[model samples]
Target: MLKRLLPVSLLVSLTALGLAQPGGLTQTLLPYTLQLNPEQFEQQGLALAQEAAQLAQFDQIELALPRAQLAVQLAPQSAKVWSLLGSLYLQKNDLDQGITALQKARLLDPKSASVLFALGSAYFQKAKYTQAVDYLQAGLKLKPNIPGALFDLGNAYYMQKRFQEAIAQYEKAIKQDANFWPAINNIGLIHYEQGEIDAAIRQWRTAISLDAKAAEPQLALAVALYTKGDREQGLALGEAALKLDSRYADLKFLKENLWGERLLKDTKRFIATPRIQASLVRTPQPLLPRTAP
Candidate 1:
């Protein structure tokens, strides 16, 4: 669930306003000067693309999609428009469309690291690990210090069961961005998967310390602590994690997020506790009767 952070709206808003001017020329009053008009359609398309990017940043995928699509239509040659559209499609969970859009962007701007990174991420989502590796490596070659790219390359490696390679990439990501809690949390996941429970716990603890409000690390540490007989604190952490993000409380959501089997089982048991059940606002459905054997 790595995502781009939403930036303050003021900058993008001003940029959009500037680009949205139909004439593509701004008259200057101070010096009594005027500039020649630029390409009007391209400017408008770029503005729409920027608007879509900002909306997507704020998790307004539904609203962003139309604007992104319109930008692509208006400026088919613009690499930025296609890249934004691809990212919007990915956020909207339309992997096929995302792949198409990102591929188009790559074709238009073969040297763009952002486009390569987006395509790699899209391939990862679609379970095309080899393609993910290729594109991610290509992106890293162009922009070696991009922590997001490094983090995702780690994930691609992890999925392929290349544990040491995954750890190396995660470590590189941490070096580039010390506060990147996701990479730290994912390193914990690898440790847990390898039966290095104590190491995993340590990584999770570090992740929680770095980002107190992060739900994933909190939930993971809770599960680890509960299994180690630290019941009270573990339960509290679990509740806090759920409070931070209710989606973590959903069974199906946990599976989709790639929770390990053991973690998922423990989480199910933890959530079934009377205290946790009482705190949940959603009611459980009635169970069907078992048929006679």
Candidate 2:
């Protein structure tokens, strides 16, 4: 008899729940309207967002963008949907759109550490260091001990030439995750900029030890070694670095990697060396002389 009554009771309960109106005391307990269920939209949006992420992983931006956009429309008030859209924009290299989506996500969920960090990272990529600092600091305050955030904060400070502050942040990152080679490598960059050659070399060596496959620290250490007259060892290290990533041999690539003015100048000199030039698979292009008309 109880089993026979179960279906009717369940149906009655669902009907009563569906009658929940929007905006009032009853709305507080059951937020969705009778016709339009907000929870269903959120669930559908989440599924679409997941599909978008999977498509993006395969570099199917054409398909991913439509799904991401649809998710946002479906779950207009969902902070997670907005954040996913923001990340998709970032992945597509649409910095302006990425920032806008992330800002919306922040508005929807002001206390979201993930949203704040995403905003900070997007700003950093945009070269808006001041704004990056503000957002990153806010995120850190909410959830400390994130190594990537600390590293990026250090990078923003480094770009502004706030060496001490940058070093402090990098150190904090290293403390949280000793295997974080980028922070160690960046600390080396600061030392090199300050003309602390031996210290810079030590830091680079440490970074290389932490992540031997990383090209940046290896190339940096090579440049420093060559500058110090250790030609053979430096050339070998440069060759190894180039093997890891041929792009690192490009001057334009180095410039984009946040090498400081002094460091870049020194790197230019180091790259000019015949041995170092020979080690690189992609040789530097020479300027052609112009003929007068």
Candidate 3:
């Protein structure tokens, strides 16, 4: 029966696929009489490289940097090692060295999304938002579904006060994965700024549903509600936010506003001095008269 022969066929396929090679391909390719001893130097080098990676993951920058440097020297062509060294340099705030190591990794693996993402992050940290945008955009063009690139692009635009563009990018990111909480919260803030109070509340509530412990959305919702006249409920929400993060200074200001304490007054005193209303709007420069013949 076909069922009875299925297991046998799979077993033969696996054997040919090298899964059954006991000593691996090199050993199988060479005769036992000609087999040499294991390369101790290569083994020691790999062991040291692994040790460096482990230390880097644990934040031991002082030891990690030197060990990773040694690993790169031992394995000059290793993309993984270079990437790790770049990350370690980034953690140490050595932007130039971090960029150099990451560039080397990119040279080794030009299409690596992770390396591109890391490089983009380094540029962003250096406040090179324009450069960050270009690199992140390139990475996204290559890998359209990369959420980090989408998020960072939105952040860059938001920092520039290009809210509409930021919203569009965030919306795209959310469409890729609706449960991306940060994008959801960002949308809520954008709506709030545009004076769409109800829509802002809805967006923030949706974000809270997606991530109940997200403090920013919760705080933003509280502020929106208080500003919209539900003082008691808003104050309670603000208090809850403060309990979640006691260091929130803005919440204290909100608390004072909700409780009717005059914290600060509008400083611009308006005086109604009557005057003739004149159209001072600059008239378009008159087209120069045609040159006379």
Candidate 4:
């Protein structure tokens, strides 16, 4: 037998007793317009933000970014959501959008050191060293032990040709994390530019010891050795470094990574060698974007 349908009154009573909306109060939640409170929105937003972060860790920024964008709309006051969106945009090389989103994040959470540092990095990408320095220094004041941020600050100073300050920041980064080899490697860059070839060699050696596979220090050290008349050793090392990462053969890539004029000249000669040229031809790996030094 067909059962009789419930009346609107009965449905309304059911909704009033905590089912769903028929046609009543705000708490009587509608189908598509289900009203979630501020806390509910924040909770959902943070969940999406966390998923985005996990995806980003897997180098899936394209998939992560849309979720983060929606999270920001839900949690407009969340510094973390805005910051994540900004960072993903930075990864995509959308610098203007990155800066704008980061600025919004900074406004939401004035004391967030990560947002400050990310903003600094965005400015660095835009070649605004002075602003980068300002924001990086501010972030460092709040969180002094972050080795990557310190390294970035060092790069900022290096870009401005403030060599000593750059080294100071790199040293601080090394102090915070002894195995932070990029800082050591960049210190080598400074020494090399200052005409202290031997000092540069030692720093690069130490950097290599810390991370044997780091191509930048390997190539830099190779250039140094080749320039210093250790032709055979330089050629061999340069070949090996090129095999490890052939993008170093591209002078423009090296320049973007903050390799200075002197080192670039030596690297040009080193890369033009027959052996390194052959290694470049053999390397099948595509170059990935490494925007930061």
The number of the candidate with the highest TM-score is 4
Worst 10 residues of 4 by lDDT: 1-10
For model 4, the superposed segments whose C-alpha errors exceed 4 Å read 1-34, 287-293
Q: List the residue pairs that clash in candidate 2.
A: none
Model 2 alpha-carbon miss at residue 265, Å: 1.9
Q: Go through the candidates in order and give each one's C-alpha lDDT.
A: 0.80, 0.81, 0.63, 0.87
Could you tell me the TM-score of candidate 2?
Answer: 0.81
Highest-scoring model, lDDT: 4
The 10 consecutive residues of candidate 3 with the worst lDDT sum are 267-276
Model 3 RMSD in angstroms: 20.2
Better of 3 and 4 by lDDT: 4
- What's each prediction's clash count? 0, 0, 0, 0
What TM-score, over all chains together, does every model reach?
0.77, 0.81, 0.64, 0.86
How big is the positional error of residue 254 in model 4, measured in Å on the Cα after superposition? 0.5
- Please tell me which model should have the higher TM-score, number 1 or number 4: 4
Model 4 residue 252 CA deviation (Å) reads 0.7
Off by over 4 Å in 3: 1-49, 55-63, 247-293
Query: Can you write out model 2's per-residue Cα lDDT over 28-110, one digit (the tens) per residue?
Result: 65333234466765676788888998998887888888778877866789898899899889877799999899999999999
- Please provide, for model 1 over 30-89, each residue's C-alpha lDDT reduced to its tens digit, 9 standing for 90 to 100: 222223243655677788899988888887889998888777755789988999999888
Candidate ranking under TM-score, highest first, comes to 4, 2, 1, 3
